[model samples]
Target: MSNYEKYLETQLQDLDFKEEYDNLEAEYQIIKAIIDARLELNLTQQELSAKTGIKQSNLSRIENGNCSPTVHTLSKIARGLDKQLVIKFV
Candidate 1:
């Protein structure tokens, strides 16, 4: 494995670190989904901002994991991407 991957693997061996990492999994998934969907549609943050009426800065923050987006914001983003937002607990 690469140095960073090896380091991360070692770090994850700690119960505390693993717990924290697992807790953030959902947030990471949300960020990945937004980024992937935007790329799939070939949409820039600015373009998405126009479509969703949300600020490009806010979108950037969300994508960067600097802030948590509300369900309303996520719904807006989904519509802007011509998608439907679905949340599930499993």
Candidate 2:
């Protein structure tokens, strides 16, 4: 590789970004999955709230992955969206 490319790579490696990267990556995945499921049902936040009996703000937070949803809340959302919530360990 070129010197510039190597230097950039070295800088990236020198930065301890694993924790930040992992957190952001997991949050991205969670939000993406929720958004995808909601989109599949053609439901807006308001509509989802209406169906799930959850407040729009709470739904928004959950969809954004800014809040960790409880199992009961997730189950309600999944039932409202006609989806299933599954938790797994990697």
Candidate 1 minimal-lDDT segment of 10 residues? 1-10
After superposition, which runs of candidate 2 have C-alpha atoms over 4 Å from their true positions?
1-19
Top TM-score prediction, candidate number: 1
Compared with the true structure, what per-residue lDDT tens digits does model 2 show for residues 1-76? 5443364356456446545645576665666677778887789999999999999999988875679888899889
Top lDDT hit:
1
- List, residue by residue over 1-90, the lDDT tens digit for candidate 1: 544347658978999989987999899789878988898898999999999999999999998889999999999999999999999999
RMSD to the true structure for each prediction, in A, is 4.4, 8.5
Give TM per candidate: 0.78, 0.69
* lDDT for position 55 in model 2: 100
